[model samples]
Target: MFLEVGGNRSTRRKPTVTRENMQTHQRDREMLIWSNPGVEPTTSLLGSQSSNHLATMQSVMYELMSELNDRSEDLERQMLSLEQRVEQLTAGFNALPAHLSATLSAQHAALVHLLRERDSRDYHRAAGGGGASDAGAVVAVVPLSPASPLTHIPSLQLLRYKLPLLRKRPPQCQL
Candidate 1:
């Protein structure tokens, strides 16, 4: 039998329909499973594109993770700083009343000492000079002994101690 060459009606030399030739024709028409430079890029192109997509996704995930870790660390630092500030404020609040009490107690003691010194001076001047002229004058005695009960007693106890013993007359007001 003869075969048409190039779809021209001209018949070429008689050709043999061999089994190997038929298999080669079928192979050309079917899909190729392997890579070939002559064929369009199908499987290789898809595989490479998928690999690129996976790499991009991994980079994005890494960036997100890094950002999250940084934010968490920043929050932890802020929490620690806030806790320290709270502690300082609490300590200051707790100490304020005690500090005020001590300061007031010291002032009261100093005032009581001054009053005693003034009375002692007035009494001596009155007995020596005369009463009316000595009434306005004031004096001070420094460095009372540590062993003195007058120096060591609490203000409440000192106020209760008999001031009449040191003065000629009684005070107008009493605790």
Candidate 2:
């Protein structure tokens, strides 16, 4: 009796069984068993390939993580530098009004001194005297005039009219 094994080729085989034919049939059976979908491949055959793929993926992930960490650190440093710069600018801005006020005070003192000297010269001339020979040595007192523009405009009002021009506008951000 002939037993059909593989395909149509097995149907044309002689009914007699020989040793070489038995070995060939065993090898074909072994191939079929190994190729079956239900059978799992041997771990020894797949181990090196899977490990190599996993190692490559791990190295790539490590490199990406390192790059991300470096960028984050760089951004942090930049933010810190920006904050320090802002602090310096804020200090300068806070001191500006005091500096300007001191300068205006000095100018006002000089102007008052000049006006007093002019008033003294006028008084001496009206009293039928020539210009003072030692004008630098003279300390003259002058009465305040109610009609002066300076008396009408206070320093605080001047600052109010001018200070808004120094204010910074908000920055517009684009998407």
Candidate 3:
């Protein structure tokens, strides 16, 4: 290549690279590679050290993968438990109306039985209690259940008569 002097091209020779200049350039390149962490040096520098760093990176990656798998399994177990609880709640909710209907049916049966007993007794009283309706009628009307609506009548006679007849108690069930 020609040399440019004062914006004019001149016929001249290019400088030759000496051995010392080549060595200095090599040293500068190596120094640059060492100073910058982004540059990976050649394995010719330290083969054992590079191998050690690779091994350490692999071990750390394995540990992280193992921990991730363990956490994922724990989360799956928790989700399964929550799903089972939800199923139990749904089952209980679905059965609520049936249970309520059964309980109400039992209470209705008891009420009907009480009404029939009261009607029978009133019929008997109207029929003159078989010719002995005064004290005998009072005694007969005293043995009904304490929970009977007949026992809560707003009357002058049957108000104090919760001990006339012992009827069968209604069936009870737990919720």
Candidate 4:
């Protein structure tokens, strides 16, 4: 009789099966079909699915990179605005008269002297001088004054310790 393997296709007709041999013959045929080594059918479909997944992942990564770049630009703009505000404040303060600047400087010097004296008195009782009293007692508050000695400028020290940004600004004053 015709055999239906898996689909509508049929093989050549054979003798009718006897009841005793039917089970044994079917088993033998099944074993022969299973033992034959052949390519799996699903490989092409699985490979295509993997490629699609990789493309989707790459698209997501590109979108995140673009977002990060946008945020970086925003931060740069904010930093520039802050710098401009600080420069405006400095200029306004510098425009004060020389007499006023000198008065402010002298007041700051007096405050520094008082603070240093107070600190020394407090620490003297605890540490008992220990021979380093002279060094520790000198509270150096270098006032950011426009009139105080040019040699006393703290920004001069910062020039050596600086990155490239400060060096690029036009020097309005020589000192």
Candidate 5:
């Protein structure tokens, strides 16, 4: 028999298979088998091992997917909880201004009532069981100081202007 040599296409004579070369080849094949005992050099055995590895890899991928899904669900629940809390806070914030206005108005009315009661008491004391002329002639005026709480109120801006006039008048009774 003849074998083609490279791209040259030259026909080379077949090598003579000596007994010694055949023995060497057999020894090399035996050594390869001996290196890994009980491991058959068969396509079927290799295919089965490859299939087992593929199954194990698929199972691992499924487990990872399940864990990812569970984590995503937990995060979604937490996000919904946070959104609910934010809505509650927003509602409270929206109602705050009206509640504050009501509180300020109540305080203003209480202050006005107190002032009127004080003025009434002062007028009665000046009258001293006398006629209406004594009550009209004697005027009891209270001086508003800069440090008073009324100065801090935005709605009581007119009171700051009226304070000077009250200060100019002399008090009938000093309390």
Candidate 6:
């Protein structure tokens, strides 16, 4: 059997037609995959589909960000309102009674004096207008026994001194 080089049916030398036909075939195959969506595609087609999916996801993210921006504006307005209410409460606190203000100032001054006495150990020097004193200035006067009678009293003292004082006891039996 001899194979003929030239076809006898059609003698068309159109290169553009062949290219167009190939492009159309590719488009048809892509359309089939796109329409049927369950069918997986080759690498090139998969890449295009992935890029399209990414673009769709990006647009959805933008829409969500826009919605969040609107909510943020409303939250900012609410925060400003809360701040104004706090300012009003602070102004009311500023209008407290003069006695209360005086008490607070006296307590603050006492606290400062105590803290200075604790840190410096020079209360007399401070009172002497920064004079060099011979002795160490004693500031604090702590009690010798800080524990209460309930926890620290001797058992004999508790029975003899405290219990008899609290309740009237019967006459002691002469053993």
Q: What is the lDDT for 145 in model 6? A: 29
User: What TM-scores do the predictions have?
Assistant: 0.47, 0.50, 0.47, 0.32, 0.52, 0.33
Global lDDT of each candidate? 0.60, 0.59, 0.57, 0.58, 0.60, 0.54
lDDT tens digits, residues 112-157, model 5?
4454555566668887755333222332333333334433554355
| Backbone collision tally, model 3 | 7
lDDT of 2 by residue, 1-175 (tens): 4655677776675676878889998897678667865554455347678899999999999999999999999999999999999999999997776666565555544644653455566658779665443332332223333333333435434433433542331122110
What is the lDDT, from 0 to 100, of the residue 89 in candidate 1? 99
How much does candidate 2 score in TM-score? Answer: 0.50
lDDT of 3 by residue, 1-175 (tens): 2333443343444455678878988998878778866554654456668788889999999999999999999999999999999999999987776665555445544544554555567668778645432323443223333334342433314423432343432243111
What is the descending lDDT order?
1, 5, 2, 4, 3, 6
Best-fitting candidate, measured by TM-score? Answer: 5
- Once fitted onto the true fold, the runs of candidate 6 whose alpha carbons sit more than 4 angstroms away are 1-41, 98-175
Clashing pairs in 4: 1-14
Off by over 4 Å in 1: 1-48, 128-175
Give one digit per residue, the lDDT tens place, for model 4 in 1-175: 5444544444544456677589887786667556643523255456678789989989999999999999999999999999999999888776765656676556545644544454566567768755434322343556655556645555334432442333232233222
**Candidate 4 global lDDT:** 0.58
lDDT score at residue 17, model 4, on the 0-100 scale: 68
Better of 5 and 6 by TM-score: 5
**For model 1, what is the C-alpha lDDT against the true structure?**
0.60
lDDT of 6: 0.54
The total of clashing pairs for model 1 equals: 0
The weakest ten consecutive residues by lDDT in model 4 span 166-175
Lowest summed lDDT across 10 adjacent residues in model 2 is found at 166-175
What does candidate 6's lDDT look like per residue over 77-170, in tens digits? Answer: 9999999999999887766454454544444345335444433455464775565322212222222222222233343222333333322222
